[model samples]
Target: MNETQSILLASACFALAFILASLLEYWLHRLMHVSKKVGARHLEHHRNNTGQGVLWEFRDYIRGAIVLIAAMFFYSWVAGIGWLLGSLAYAAFSAYAHQLQHENPTKCFWMKMPVHYVHHKYGMWHHNFGLAVDWWDKVFGTYKLVDWLTEEELSQPEKNLLQLRWW
Candidate 1:
């Protein structure tokens, strides 16, 4: 393939990997609601309404995705690098999103509504499973729109969007 075609192929791989990561996140979260073993661990987050810090969350995501990343590398170096970068970017974004929603849902302006925030705030078992983005929830027909901000939240002092636990 020409250099231009190689670059395009890598770019496509990157986009595909990013999308697949989001889909995996959505499904894994959904699974936590139904599978006893998975739910057992996930229950702690619901009970606490807190997230394991962003770095830890990122690490967990990378740990889970390492095998796929390795497989991609074995297939093609260019595609693998693109996939790896995309996966890492998604992991970082998702980790931050999860922690931010837990710490200050109001700050998550990327989404029309922070789905994970609503999921925990309302104790929902079957809706709003998307963490990084709400696209999957909408596509899967699991998105539920509601007035999520509470009186307490409204009354609280405003916080900086970046004021989240990173470690």
Candidate 2:
């Protein structure tokens, strides 16, 4: 392939990897809800309403996908690098979003409603499984809009957007 074609292919791979990561996240979260063993672990998060820190979360994501990332390199070096960057970017963003929602759901500005926050706060077992974004939830017909911020949240002291566990 020409240099231009290689670049375009890499770019396409990046975008595809980014989107695939989100879709995978949505499905994995849903799996956790349905699988008893997984749900047992996930229940701890619901009970605590806390995140395991951004870096740790990202590490977990990378750890889980390491083999897939390696397989991407076999396709092509450019594609592999692009996919790696895109997947890492999404993992980082999702980790940050997860932690932010746990610390202060109001700080999540990208979404009109932070789905994960409501999922946990409302004990929704069958809805709002998307962790990074709500696109998949909407696509799968699992998205539900509820009054997220109650009087309790409204009355609580405001928190700084960056005041989250980042370790």
Candidate 3:
């Protein structure tokens, strides 16, 4: 229960929780666009007419606040402020990445932005599946190119990945 031990323990626990949450996020992303119809709830997100954007998904924002508070409370009880900070940071980063990834060209890894945009447009369910970073997608082998970004489109490197977006 020394200071160093507490810090190490907290860091480990925080990393474990973050990895689990990130993995879960990948699956959740896949589910949202699983079908072309967009399911009942996600359909709202797909509507170009409503002028809704992913960042304004109010349902998720409200739910996220509650979950974040609860997670912080639980982490604080078990491992003190360090763990709470780690978990909160992880949660906030994940949510921010999800929103930013889909939002306009705000501050983000520019290289991945177009790739993800293609995924969104073409429904590349398997590719660009990771949020917060594409590290997971690259690790998991689920990364696929937008169908149009085939051998030809990639060679040019300026055709908007063609029109297939995601394969």
Query: Which candidate wins on lDDT?
Result: 1
Off by over 4 Å in 3: 35-39, 49-83, 110-116, 145-167
In order of appearance, the predictions have TM-scores of 0.96, 0.94, 0.60
lDDT order of candidates, top first = 1, 2, 3
Clashes of 2: 0
| Residue lDDT tens for model 3, 6-67 | 77877776776667656666676667767655345755644541213343433353364446
- Going through the candidates in the order shown, the clash numbers are 0, 0, 3
**Model 1 residue 167 distance off true place after TM-score fit, in angstroms:** 0.9
lDDT of each: 0.91, 0.89, 0.53
The C-alpha local distance difference test score for the whole of candidate 1 amounts to 0.91
Which pairs, if any, clash in model 3? Answer: 122-166, 127-144, 146-165
Better structure of 1 and 3 per lDDT = 1
Tell me the alpha-carbon RMSD of every candidate.
Answer: 1.1, 1.3, 7.5
Decoy 2 TM-score against native: 0.94
Instruction: Look at candidate 2 and tell me the lDDT of residue 105.
Output: 88
Candidate 1: 10-residue stretch with minimal lDDT: 148-157
lDDT of 2 by residue, 59-158 (tens): 9888988887777899899999889888988999999999988878888888989999999888999999988799999999999999897886788679
In model 1, how large is the Cα lDDT of residue 134? 99
